[model samples]
Target: MEIILEKTTKPFFKKHAGSQALAKERIGAILEREQATGLTKVKLALRQPVAGRPCFELRCNLAKLGSVRVAFILDGQVARI
Candidate 1:
């Protein structure tokens, strides 16, 4: 399996100094977890404020599955499995 990370996702990972392997692992984990929940595809967005705030959004295929718009932050990293 393969996953494509959007351009918007890059900055977050870069900011965190995340390694490629770590990013791949995190993404793969999410994909596997989602698949176990009967979802074939998912879209995830992560945003972190310069002042140390974090937020995230997750969607399954185009339908909103989870929205943590301003509650939680995500480290930009993605994988597929």
Candidate 2:
């Protein structure tokens, strides 16, 4: 299984530097364990749920993200759907 992450806003990081570091540490651990193969190994990996689950739902204007690459609009450097 692949885990998808939504890019966080810059303002948020600016406000929570210490918390962000801790989060990165925990995330790194999860990604390391998740790299193992097989159901048993996968099941044994450390599991941590997002504090605010489904932090962001990428939705394109009008409807869902379209087939074309243009579906994603770049806001300066940040990409938006």
Candidate 3:
């Protein structure tokens, strides 16, 4: 089975410098753990919002890491879903 992980960047981070890079690193760490658990990095994206404000949503698939499904969002440096 495959699982998808999604993370949304908050409004504040969009205005802060280096937030995108930080988000990438933070998300990378999560992906690394998934890889260690036998999952493959299938797909990823940094989404743009349609209205209100702009945000990023990263989507990844974990087909090799059992049947567990996980999704999360990032608020600044915090991870939530």
Candidate 4:
């Protein structure tokens, strides 16, 4: 699976993450883990479809940043964050 960050994700990180780089790194780590294990470690909740593809909310907790939640839609082998 591939992770693709959406445009709004930058502002989201600016507001909720202490370090945007770290947050992105975390997302990359999640991607790596998922690709390796074929399992999602972060909290994922199924949501309504967007453009006919199923959506999901991925929740991550940053040590000093509290919980950061991002909604994404899956299209083929890519996840649009």
| Per-residue accuracy of model 3 over 1-81 as CA lDDT, tens digit each | 122223343443455545445444555666556446644443332355323333333353323322322344333434433
Q: Model 4: per-residue lDDT, tens digit, 1-81?
A: 566777877777667656876666676566555546754654445655677866666666655766777666656567778
The better candidate by lDDT, 2 or 4, is: 4
Candidate 2: stretches off by over 4 Å: 1-9, 15-17, 38-81
Q: Please, what are the lDDT tens digits per residue for candidate 1 over residues 1-81?
A: 355555665665585563545555445555557557754443333443523533333432211222212112333332312
Best by TM-score: 4
Q: What's each prediction's clash count? A: 4, 0, 1, 0
Ranking by TM-score: 4, 1, 2, 3
Off by over 4 Å in 1: 40-81
Residue 21 lDDT in candidate 2: 48
Model 4: ten consecutive residues of lowest lDDT:
38-47
Q: What is candidate 4's TM-score against the reference?
A: 0.56
Cα lDDT of model 2 by residue, 1-81, tens digit:
222224634454476554544443443344334334221222211233234221122221212222111112223223232
Estimate candidate 3's alpha-carbon lDDT, on a 0 to 1 scale: 0.41
List ranges where model 3 is wrong by over 4 Å.
1-18, 40-81
Q: Model 2, residue 52: what's the lDDT?
A: 26
**Best lDDT goes to which candidate?**
4
Winner by TM-score between candidate 2 and candidate 1: 1
